[model samples]
Target: MSLKILITGAAGFIGSNLCEYFVSMGHDVLGLDNLSTGSLSNIEGLRLKDNFNFLKGDIRDIETCRKAVLNRDYVLHQAALGSVPRSINDPITSNDVNVGGFLNMLVACKDAGVKKMVYAASSSTYGDSKALPKVEERIGKPLSPYAITKYVNELYADVFYKTYGLNTIGLRYFNVFGRRQDPNGAYAAVIPLFTKQLMNKQSPTINGDGTYSRDFTYIDNVIQANEKAMLTVHPEAVNSIFNIAYGERTDLKMLVDLLKMSLSKYDKSILNIEVIYGPVREGDVPHSLASIDKAKRILNYQPQFNLRDGLDEAVDWYWSHL
Candidate 1:
């Protein structure tokens, strides 16, 4: 059945994609974004659709949050200031947007009597743990302010459910990358950054000897997780957290080689480009891999695209932008 949904950060990389998916499925989507980090170009393609509505606002404002949540069947809260390095530089802004704003959304949702609230959490919350595949039950210390914010989100989410009986689900995203992930900014993710550099015949930057690994989930996988979480019939799945990642790992070195190989077919200059290695940034994890058994069991979450396919699509998008 089609539902009335409110998607915060709907102009963002993942949020925009979610809007498109839901609109195509004949659902009514109300998208709220302040244009901070999100661009209108990302959602412009959807504004012409009759089922999609766009509202420019910040989640930090409780009134705005309350207004957006009114009569919404489900709330997909994707508005957050991502990136560990950005958080490390300005923790207060990150805290206000990620933690403070998240709290506001939860309270607003509870008051508005929304059916369910599914939010975007981060895998960085599993900081410093050496577990091969991270489970939701086991977590280590938060290494960065960003990780702390995400962990705190889970805490607040649980508390809200316990205190007010608000149905909430947190999907912990790991290294999500794909089309519309901004590649020109200083805070761009490795995949988009590397893709852009390769397309432009420029060197890509790698840190810490290119040995650092990540789960490297795709955009489609994240969207599927969100869709499943929002529509799951199991009562146990509600008011819980799940990892939204493909259960695999890829190191930086391998990623660079893959990007060059893919780009070389169209542009030979990419093959001669060298990746520059530098100091590892603070608050960055060395390796990250997620166990999706819990998500599979609960939400029936299955990732449709792996890293190679995701990278191919990402690079192709960059090629178009260039």
Candidate 2:
């Protein structure tokens, strides 16, 4: 049976990808985005599709959120104000959009009788724990305002499920990067930012002595987790948080070198560019690596793209488009 779905942040990098995939699968997809961080050009192609609908609105507005959820079978809640530094500088707006807006979506999803809400949680929730291969059941105190908000999201999801019988699956995303990820922002993700810098023959700066590592998951893996979370009938999967990652770690120095290698295929001059090291920014974890055993056992998630392969593909896209 064809399902009706609502994807928040549908104009964003991950959200637009989700919209395209689901719509192509013959599902009716309604996309809601305020276009703050998301660009309309990301989904302008889908706007012409018959089964795809777009709503220019904000999730902070309960009325708009309620309207978007009407008749939708599932809600992919990806709308949020991301970035640790931004959250640190302006915690109030981040809370308003991430926490308050998240509540509105939960209420709308609950009121509309939506089946499941698969949301984008963050690996930042792992916080300050020194544990290698961070697990779902074990977590430490939040290290930043952004981390606190994401942790709160998981808590809220649990409460909603227990109290009102709402079904939700939280995918704690690690350093996700792929096509459509914006490289032009004060808070741009590492991969895209570095890719753009190399493209421009500019040196990409490394924060700290370049030892900080992250799981650095590809976007496709994240989409797979969302699909599994939405359609899985497994009784144990609902109302749980799963780490969505490639189950590997690459440090900043290695990441830049690998990125340089990929970009060199297009412009060999990029290989000669230097890397500048700077002081570490606040609210950043020293290292992050996910233990994907829980997601593998429950969601049956097998990430196809490791960092090198995913970076090659992403570099190809950037070369052709950028």
lDDT of each: 0.92, 0.94
Candidate 1, pairs of clashing residues: none
| Model 2: how far residue 19 lies from native, Å | 0.7
Candidate 2 deviant stretches above 4 angstroms: none
State TM-scores per candidate.
0.98, 0.99
Query: Candidate 1 clash total?
Result: 0
Highest TM-score: give the candidate number: 2
Winner by lDDT = 2
Clash totals in order: 0, 0
Q: After the best TM-score superposition of candidate 2, give how far the Cα of residue 300 lies from its true spot, in angstroms.
A: 0.7
For candidate 1, give the lDDT of residue 100. Answer: 94
lDDT of 1 by residue, 1-322 (tens): 8899999999999999999999999999999999989999998989999999999999999999999998999999999999999999999999999999999999999999999999999999999988878999899999999999999999999999999999999999999999899987879888888888778777888988999999999899999999999999897898899998999999999999888877777788788888899899898889999999999998999898988888888777778776
After the best TM-score superposition of candidate 1, give how far the Cα of residue 43 lies from its true spot, in angstroms.
0.5
For model 1, the run of ten residues with the poorest summed lDDT? 313-322
Query: Using alpha carbons, what is the TM-score of model 2?
Result: 0.99
